[model samples]
Target: MDNIFKSAMRGALFFAAACLLLWGIVPEWKSVCAGLLLGAFASFMNALLLRRRVEIVGQAMANRGMRKMGLGLGSRIAMVLCVAMVAYKYPETFNLPATLAASMVMPFILLVSAFLHHKRH
Candidate 1:
């Protein structure tokens, strides 16, 4: 429950930051909302998958050797490749530029926030 709440909050924060930044640059409310929604969905999906992957890897690593860890990494790589292929095939629907921009913005804001939080602490 705590993990789920944390993930939701993180997604919301990323969505808000990307929307605010892009709104300042684009000056279009529709575009800003679109970007925010995209960012939030992407971040939430990524976080959920990442958390699951980490948990699986941790469990596997406890009983298995390093040689057996390739499956987890391979799955992640395959997932990335699949997403890339879909993006490539349906670029019009995907809106690669906006997607990439939102994707980059979320991580950038998260990193900056982490740095600031660390500095303050």
Candidate 2:
């Protein structure tokens, strides 16, 4: 429960920071809000899903003696395909620049989550 709260707070902070940055650059409150909300949601979802998938792959690697490099390559390819599909399906909602920004924000989300998790431990 504590860990979950910490993670949520971390995600919120990341979202706010990203929003502020976007607002500063774009100077449009509505667009900035939309972009920030969508970007933060995407980043959070990506982190959660990717973490689960990576854990499964890690377990498989441990059991089968698989190479980490192959896992890394596969994950990268999967991410690209997933992003492409999203972009294709929702072009209006996700343009190239917004998608790029959202992608860039994901690592910050993950880093915040990790930091909170580590602090709890």
Candidate 3:
């Protein structure tokens, strides 16, 4: 979890700088930046939510016989849905492809972190 957080933060900083550079150089890319930033944010939020959900479920399982998964996964999905919808609606500003691609940043971060950790060990 700590590693996840660290990687997410590092990826976010890298994305932020890339977004800022895009925002400055290309006017059209502003939309790309918007979508990319939003997607990156969703990735970060996902990591945190997943960690929290795991903790909650673990606690519930220890306390009770059969506990339901009470994570607000619906709301989380809705959040990403809302963003995707907005980006889709305004294709000129927020391109769908870029947004979708950017959403995978966290996975990339995780992979890189894992690889580095493995190599170090």
Candidate 4:
């Protein structure tokens, strides 16, 4: 399996475990799980995006594929905007602070997950 994917899986597991610990066990953070889940999903999508980008750069596609590349990038941006809009419009369900916090920690999760996965092997 690709190292990046392994890392992403680890990150998702870690996030889920942490969320369960906090929301299931700790009453204070019970309401934040929804946002946390959204954030985790976003992070997973981001990882896939990164992997695709790596593949694109790795292949060194010619001008013909550049349009597809641009479209992909545009779609990613749209996803980001949608996430923001959803969280903003539905704060009760999404929890702004928690969602933002999750968004911020996504990259960190990716890195830590990758590192731990690498270390285990």
TM-score (all chains, Cα) for each model: 0.49, 0.49, 0.78, 0.71
Give the per-residue lDDT of model 1 (tens digit) for 1-121: 3344464557567567766676667754554355444545565455456657777777778978563344554654454454445555665444445544544453454555566556776
Give the TM-score comparing model 1 with the true structure, all chains together. 0.49
Task: Give candidate 3's TM-score.
Answer: 0.78
lDDT by residue (1-121, candidate 2, tens digit) is: 3465457647666666767677678754545355445555555555565666677677878899664444544664466556656665776555545555665576765566677777878
Better of 3 and 4 by TM-score: 3
Rank the models by lDDT, top first.
3, 4, 2, 1
By TM-score, how accurate is candidate 2? 0.49
Per-model CA lDDT versus the true structure: 0.54, 0.60, 0.76, 0.69
* lDDT score for candidate 1 against the true structure: 0.54
Q: Which 10 consecutive residues of model 2 have the lowest summed lDDT?
A: 67-76
Which residue segments of model 3 deviate by more than 4 Å?
A: 60-68, 71-73
Q: What tens digits encode model 3's per-residue C-alpha lDDT throughout 30-102?
A: 8889888777777777766766787778888899867665637786676677778878999878877777777
Better of 2 and 3 by lDDT: 3
| Candidate number with greatest lDDT | 3
CA lDDT for candidate 4: 0.69
Best by TM-score: 3
